[model samples]
Target chain A: MKTLWSGSREGSLLRYRAMAFTVGTGLLLLVFVGIPIQIWGHSKAVVAVVGPIHGYLYLIYLAAAFDLARRERFPISRLFVMISAGLVPFVAFIIEHRIVASLRAEERSDATAS
Target chain B: MNRESDRQVRWVAPRALVAHLLVLCFVPGCLIAGWWQATVAMSGNGLSYLYAFEWPVFAIFSVVLWWNFLHDDPDEVGGRRLRELRRDESISGERAELRSPDFRTEDEDDELRAYNDYLAQLAQRDRAKGWRSR
Candidate 1:
């Protein structure tokens, strides 16, 4: 069976970091920036125009997050949290910060032990 | 262990990358085309079709990518090498020790023990087969 984080640990960690950043940023931009701008500045026509794009991007974000979670062997409970973060407005950023901090701590402890 | 050669290792095939890129390119292209159609021709149905198609296609694409990611090679290059070295040394030493004169009597004793074990195994298998046949 293939091992989780099959790439170099550093590479895997960096990928996870990037995944968290992009997914978090993408969700934030959609919920905070894109949705609000569409609601305030333009017609419902504008929401019609941009909503699908945001949805597609959000799907991509979730996929990236799931990939990172699987590679990291994240616990089932934490994985649920990570997955749910994208669905809620502004939660992605918060979860991103928390996950990154936890991952960094894990890496530090692993390094110290080895 | 060639470091340069190791650097060249890639889990993803070139064809798969191209396929993924095409899907990525097509999703945006379809979205853009749908938007233009909506603006110029006022085709709401066309826009709806684009929106409907986008999610399912993207969902499948994401699943495929994650499957590939999960099946990527293990990262045990150095550890595997060390394991092989240790295994070889242990096997060779065992062989050398087994060749000594004192080991001859032990080997005969082991062979007698193995004969008894084999008889026991055969009897167990026969009993299992008999039960199955019944």
Candidate 2:
């Protein structure tokens, strides 16, 4: 199990994973922590602070994920799902894990065979 | 524009229809959302401004993607039927890259010699495989 933080390797997945985690945590904060406060508690502080940050992080996540997806030759449908993972809370994290595992499984024996 | 480019820009293909409908719904929807967010921001939820600005960008991005899908050629770069799946693609792609003539073959070092030998072996194996297939 390669923990996301344990390796600083510059593989294609690393940047996308980092962005996914960043955007995922930001979204979790915005939805679970921020929006609830805004709605029920009548406070905009958390949403104000976290929302823009999430917006920008989502942008970076989009670019990173798109680049990696093309490199890995993912189908268009998977690319759309990857794009949407940013907007849905916790989905980014789930998709990130899927991406990492998929890429590893792909390259495992194949990497050395070359 | 040429007739071929005209055919590509037509929006009747099933995938093209999907893209067309999405852009139809998405761009105006984003704008409306942006306007609504502007009202929310005006009412003092300062963070609503983020979405106010963001929605328009999303609308633009969708248009860009839609435009791309309209003109995409399945065999061309960025035009490969992106969602089309084929097993062994990863293996075949990597193999092609390894055999592509980017590496120096004639350097005097032992590694280069070995690489040249490896390339020769790959070529021989490929020729054999081609013969076998035929």
Candidate 3:
């Protein structure tokens, strides 16, 4: 179609990366910083603030992952893994890194072939 | 994979079967929790009533996700049609069409299939035009 991607896929990739970074940071702070401070430091402050932020960021992460997965035609299982990656600490970072590297490689090959 | 072959594979695949079984169990668990909360709400518990609605929404969301997983097309992982739809909407300034429909109907899936077919036709025409111009 005349309007299809306007010959670009970079937009989705950029959006996905931004969301992944945000979610990953939020998750790390909640899991490592917030939880530890709440438990040992006897402070509810970190948990009180970080908990809701992490929850909301996770929801947005799910949406972002879904959008990217749809654009990339990711298999449902892969999509699930991408979505779940936001739930655990460090997983989002690893998955995002791999996704960026693989996509870049594919784009390079596509450009060469075309 | 084609629909029939996909279905056959899913049927034989242990992981798929396990996933489906988990979904079946999870849905009923959500429903039962909803029902329990609803009953508690009848006794005038305000928070329980809120939870009653939440549980069913969770169940519905799970079912929708499961259905999408089951029916997902292996070939469309490239999201070509989706990108086209977004681009067309952007150019036409017609974002309303992409918004959720106002009314749900039994034939919603059929309508979506028809829309995809239309998009595919437009894509094919565009490809032909591009070839001619080149």
Candidate 4:
């Protein structure tokens, strides 16, 4: 099937990474810069704007993560962890790093076996 | 998808039990959270309206993910790749994974056995002719 990815493992991984960071940054801004300022500064402006943007970006993040998980065939438990990582702060960045490390390790093993 | 009864669907399996629990608890949790957001939206919080919609979508996503997980065989996905890279010299990941055998559907296992047998016959015939790919 035609997808955002070019049917290459590398392409999907790259896409997932890009989405993770984009979503991560969106969440960070919403939590730190947006919500805090809105609370103390008596402004609905930042939360009103950043809130929906982060919400929509999260949907994209879910799609990207699902695509990468399908390509990689990650264990269901691991996939659950990856999904949860998006809901919490700073977890997506850590999970993404771990996923990259594991993927590299798998590639190394595949190279040796082949 | 139209396979026979050879592949048993393991609904009560340990992993499936966990998945069932997750679906039961998570779906309601999301709907309730959505309800709370709806109330907040009614109170004039515009952003809460978007959140109210998003929560139900999250619930739907969880159900889909749970179904896929229920039907999944942990390592039988050929490493979960959507497609094999078809290069002349490439060895499929399944063949390369000698560590542990994945439990595939009976139909697929039989097909794989037949294919391997065909390859073996070709190799034997090639050796008998005293030349390879000539």
Best by DockQ: 4
Q: After superposition, how far is residue B69 of candidate 3 from its true place, in Å?
A: 1.6
Best by TM-score: 4
Cα error, candidate 4, residue B23 (Å): 0.7
- What is the C-alpha lDDT profile of model 2 across B1-134, one tens digit per residue? 26437554666979889888989999999999999999999999877888899889888878877775676545553433322122234444567678666655444599777877787677556434311122
Worst ten in a row by lDDT for model 3 chain B = B125-134
Q: On residues B1-134, what C-alpha lDDT tens digit does candidate 4 reach at each position?
A: 34423567789988789889989999999999999999999999877999999999989989988877766664466434322223211333334354225332355667787876676565445433310112
Q: What share of the true interface contacts does each candidate keep?
A: 0.12, 0.15, 0.19, 0.38
Q: Order the candidates by DockQ, highest first — what do you get?
A: 4, 2, 3, 1
DockQ comparisons of all candidates to the true complex = 0.08, 0.10, 0.09, 0.20
Chain A only TM-scores, each candidate in turn: 0.68, 0.85, 0.88, 0.91
Question: Candidate 1's residue-wise lDDT over B22-58, tens digit each?
Answer: 5677567656765554565455454465566555555
Better of 1 and 4 by TM-score: 4
Q: Provide C-alpha RMSD values for all models, in order.
A: 15.7, 13.4, 19.5, 14.7
Output the lDDT of residue A70, model 1: 57
Cα error of candidate 4 at position B130, Å:
47
- Across B79-116, the per-residue lDDT of candidate 3 in tens digits comes to 64444344444433432344336433356598777886
Candidate 2: clashing pairs of residues: A75-B82, A75-B83, A76-B82, A76-B83
